[model samples]
Target: MTKISQLDANDGRAELMTDEDVIARIFDHIDNGTTDRGQSSWKEPAVNYQSVDRLDAELALLRHRWIVFCPSSTLEKSGDYIARDAAGIPLIVVRGSDGEVRAFRNACRHRGVQVAKDEGCTSVFVCPYHGWSYGTDGSLRSVPNGDGFPGLEKETRGLVRVDCLEQAGLIFVRQNAGADRSESVPDMPDLIPDSFRVVKSEAMEIEANWKLHLESALEGYHIRSTHQTTFFPVQYDNLTVVEAFGENSRIAFPYQAIERLRGRPKTDWSANGRITYVYHLFPNVIISTFPDCMQVVVIEPLGLERTRQHMFLLTDCAEGGEVLEAVFKGQEFAAKGAIEDRDVVMSAQRGLKSGANDFLEFGLFESAIGRFHTVLKREIEIPAF
Candidate 1:
C-alpha cells in the first residue's frame, strides 16, 4: 500500500503521468482536460470572528441551543445537550411526551432555585430548589407550598423558557435568554439534507482563541510545509479555494496528481472532476471532506485563550479493512499534520494580542482567508465596544 507522504521530492508538476509527461495514458481523455483549482479569491483575512468582541455572542448561542447531537433517526438512540443560560443558570432541552422537543430553564418558580442535570426521560422535572415540580411541557404541575402563598399562580410560575431550532442536523439557540422562539423559528430552515448529518464525534479542549483554531481548519496552504512528509503535499499537491460569507471560506483539491505519482488504483473519484469540498461556516463550524469521508468541527471557546474542538467523523466504511485503512490512513496523516499548523496559529494568537503584528498578510491564492477576515469584521462591530 502506497502512502501520500512518501513521494519523490524532485518530482515536479511537469512529471505528472499525463499524456504530456507519461509515455502512456490510463484512459482516453474527456473533452474537458483536468487542471486543479476551484473558485478562489485573491484577498487577505479581515473577518469579525478574529477579534475578541464576537466571543460573547457565539458562546451564548452554543449554550442556549443545548443538547445538540444526532437525530435518533441516525443514531437509533437519544442524545441531548443540557447547558447554562446567560446568568449561569442551567436549562434542559429534551423530547417531550409527544416526541417533540422542549426547552425549559432548570429552575424552580416557587423559591427560585435549581433543577436537574444530565438528561434522561423524566415524566416531570421536580425542582430541588423547592418541592415544586414541572412537567416535561414546562407546566408547574405540583407545588409543595400550596397554602404558603395563597395567591401564587402555578401557571405564571413554570421554568423560564428559551428558544431552539433544528436545521441541517444542528440545534441553534439565540444568545439572549428571553429571545422569542417564534422569531427564532422564522429564521431557521425547516428541512435539512442528510449530507449535513453526523455520525461519531468527540470534543477536545485546547489553549487558543476560538477563531484562530476555527480559521486554521478552513485553509490548505499549510499542507505543503506543515504536512510535508505526512501528507500528499510533500509528494504532490495543489490548491483551489473559494470564499464564502465575510469570515467563511471553502477549499477543494483533486487527489489525481498524488494518485498518479503514488501509483494508487484509479478510483471513481475524478482527477479532474468530482472535487471534494472543505467548507467553513462563519464563526465556528467547518466540514472537511475527502471522497469517502467528512469530518465536521464545531468549536467552543473556553476563554480568551481556550477553545473546545468538537469533531465529528462520517464515513461510508461501515467497517474497517485494508481498503478503509488506505483512505483513513491518509486522513489520520492529514490530521497529525494539523498539529503543526496549530503550533503556528496558536503562537500567532499570543503574538497578535501584543498589538505589534497589527496587520496580517494574505496571498492572491489565499482568497479564502481574505473572505474570512472580511466577515469577521462585520460580526464583531458593537456600538459601545
Candidate 2:
C-alpha cells in the first residue's frame, strides 16, 4: 500500500516512487516469490456486465467524477482543441489564448450541432448548420443573421461550459457542473515530461464492455497466454509491483532484462528500459509509460456491447532517427498486445449470455481488477445526481 499520496506533500504534487525505489521493490518481490495481493478475493455478478440498467448507472456515475480526457501534450498550442464523446457527452477541450485549458459541450447553441469535429487548431468554432460561432473561451462571438434573432442575448448563448483542468500534463474534465472541484483526481506517476509531444492520435471501437478492457490492463496473469509472441518474450510472467493511491493504481510489468541490475550499484538502477508502467486512472483512462514513448488511453462506453478507445502516443523526439524508430517500435509492440487482449475480451463479452456462472471470481493475482470493481460499486451506489 505504498500510495503516491504519501510520497510527498507539495499541494497534491506528490512524487512518484523513484526508479530506484520501484526497481528495488521489484527485485524484492522476485526473490520472495510473491506479488501484491488484495485483502480478499471478490466476485462481481456476470449479469452486471450485460444489463442495460447497470450500464446506465455506471455511465451516470462517470459524470460525477473527473474523467481524463487527453494528455496536455495533445493540445500543445493555444486554440488547439480535441472534440470527442466522453461519458456519452460530446465535449470540446481547447487551450485558450490565455494558455489555459477549457472544455465546452460540443453542441452549438443555435442548432444543437457540434461546432467542431475531431482535433485541430482554430481560434473560433463555427457551427456548420447555422453559422453560429464561439471563441476558444466559449463565448458566443457571432451569429449568421444579426436582425433575425433580435432578442437573443449573445452573453448566455455560448457553448455550454464544462469544468476542465490541466494537471500533471493531463487534462481532466468534470461533466457534472455541480461536482466539487476539490475532489481528488488520479494520483499519477510523473512519467510524462514537459518535453514530450503528441506523435500520434488514433481512435477505435471494440465490441466489449469497457470494464473488460480495463481488466485486461490491470493484471499480468494473462501475459504468458495472451501475449506469448508480443510481450511475454521481453516481460516476466505474473511478476509486477502494484501500488494503489486514492482510487487509482499503478501496475509495473518488469522486463526480464531487469536481472542485469542484480549486482549493480543501486544508484545506477533505472526503470526506463526495464519496465512498463500501466496506470489505471480510475473509471476509464489508462496511461502507460513505455521505453521510448508514453500512451494515454481513454475508453468511453458507446453502447451496452460497445466501447470506443482513444489512444494518443507522446514522445520527446521531434525528428526521424533512432529515437523515432524506437518510439514507433514501442507503439507497435503495445498495439499488438492490445489487439490480443481485445480479442479475448470480446469473447468474454459474448460469454456473458451463456449463464455459466452467476459471479465472475477475481483471484489474488488479479487484485487490481477486484479493487476497481469495489470502487466502482461504491461510487455507483451513491445515487447519481
The regions of model 2 sitting more than 4 angstroms off are: 1-16, 183-189, 318-320
lDDT of 2 at 114: 95
Instruction: Compute each candidate's TM-score over C-alphas.
Output: 0.64, 0.92
Tell me the number of clashing residue pairs for each predicted model.
Answer: 16, 0
Worst 10-residue lDDT window, candidate 2: 1-10
Question: lDDT tens string, model 2, 1-385?
Answer: 1122332211132345777888998888889987766667879998889899999888887876778899898998999999998899999999999999999999999879999999999999989998999999999999987699989999999999988987788898988844355544655546578888888999999998888878999998888999999999998788887777667778889998999999999988987788899888887989888886788999999888899999989887664578878899878878888999999999988887678889889988887788788777767775424
- Candidate 1 structure lDDT: 0.52
Best by lDDT: 2
Residues 26-56 of candidate 1 have per-residue lDDT tens digits of 2222112322232444333333335455566
